[model samples]
Target: MNYFSHNPLNRFSEIRPDTAKMGELWRHEQARVLVVSNNLSLLQAEAREAAFLQQQEAVALANQAEVRVYLGSEGEVPYFALGFAGLPPALLPEAYELHDLRQVALQLPQEQSALLAYARGMVHWNLRHLYCPDCGSLTYSTAAGHVRQCSSEACNKHHFPRTDTAIIVLISEGDACLLGRQKVWQPGMYAVIAGFLEPGETLEQAVAREAEEETGVSLQSIAYHSSQPWPFPSSIMVGFQAVAVNRELQVNYDEMEDARWFTREQIVAGLQNGTLRMPPQFSISFRLIRDWFNQTGAYKLEELVSA
Candidate 1:
């Protein structure tokens, strides 16, 4: 998804749009990327070798194999790219670990292109989620890399790749937008109001509810903008513009230290000076906030998760 963000994501007939199409493309060249696992006691240096040696069952043909995705390499390092046909059977019992794609992406060098990030992340998801919850049997990669189907002849359940759907909104009244900061945020860093989408809720509903719940401000109108695939463990952030008919700051210490309105002048200073830390440039939120400000002033439309 990040790969398509730059290129003709739609133009590439080879690229899959949603989870289904995407997985189809991934399985065709699915490679195993390793994340140091708890079993290995990766915190210790000596433990890794023994863990690797012990994981005979999982590494049948993996070792001595060209590490396709090297921790440090020009191309991908030594990693097993498995096919839907014999993956789980090839990898079990050994304790060799697998990590979610998002976690892996976090550790990668900033220079690593988004394409590698996407490929590695997607494959990792397939590797970790190899079984169906319904039948409790192993599920094989399917629909290319987009899905996993239970091997049980009877249950036949299908599991698709999942991305957390959240709505991040620019709640504005006049020349100001609502912003807040998590206690964990970089000092002085503040960004748009956001929250996950609960079941039975639409993006607009989520936005309105989050604004009300987080800041006790009721939104009058909601406008859908764009989206971004946040592989911070796989979330797709949908962006929105909500007009706040009133100005009110509410604090919910459990989630945020504070919530309040930021006039256009305040945001402009924050962006240019970095005196106020913004979300990484790679994040849609940064772009969203940036674009919004640029357009008469806030984040861009495409800065949303979907766009």
Candidate 2:
């Protein structure tokens, strides 16, 4: 049920390498562009559109963009992404509203949210990698801006966008599931254990390690749940359901401020009352929790809160 999980449009990854065809599509009148500036996007409420600007609107902000990436196509219409690390206020049309990507992710339609996640990830990658990692030379955008190349004659290396893989798991032991809250999070907010994958470690290893490190709980029978594109700067959140091998709890202060196990009844009560705060409905964390709760026919937060 996460916002960025299912995308309707075809990525057309096969055609991204074709520079000539991409160029032609970019010049097409019906081509759509998503403009991302300073982690915000151009949103038009009237049209229920998410940052997806027309070609003319995109061209108007050409001076503000550092790079434009071809973000594949939907049928015959092409989609492009414009990256703006520093966007000028004047360039933003009064007709459109500027909203943070996080807010957009929750408020926008699922299809639009998915598209924005993809575009924002590509934009962030283009903005951060302006130089070659190998040669220390200025890089130029190529392959419809999907690939960047080193300008140096001695060492011309091609670079592509990268996604960091992170594992988030709901660790359960019989009737209760473990949840942790970071110090920086809201007062009552809690989420499942999550951490980036270390080199030479499998997803199962990551789930076991993160669980133990954060809550001092060992996990058994790790199973994949679902994955979501969390473009909070290009991250693929891999969700999993893992059963805790032990009942003992050891909270790691460095990783989490608080860690505890909540029973299904407690979670339901928390949702009914205001004692707990869940992640946004559009997040994989929410989906993981909801999916786990659904087995017991427990009422969801939306039902409790909306009532």
Scored by lDDT, the top model is: 2
Q: Once model 1 is optimally superposed onto the true structure by TM-score, how far is the C-alpha of residue 19 displaced, in angstroms?
A: 20
Candidate RMSDs in order: 9.5, 1.7
- The top-ranked prediction according to TM-score is 2
Cα lDDT tens digits for candidate 1, 1-307: 2221441112232332244544333232322333223111111131222122212233454443221122121232222232221234344334444433333433433333243334444555675677788979988765444667899999989887687899998888988877888988878888888999999998888998898888889888999878876645467789888898799767677878877788767765655665665665566676667667767734432332223
Tell me the tens digit of each residue's lDDT in model 2 across 1-307: 5678667777787887787888788889999988888777778864467756778877878656798888777888888888788778788777787677676565678788888778778888888899999979999888777889999999999998998999999888998888889898888888899999999999989989999888889877899999989889889999999998878998999888999998878887886778888877788888898788778754765665455
Give TM per candidate.
0.63, 0.95
Error of 2 at 66 (Å): 0.8
Off by over 4 Å in 2: 46-48
Write down the worst ten-residue block by lDDT for model 2: 297-306
Model 1 / residue 175 / CA error / Å: 1.8
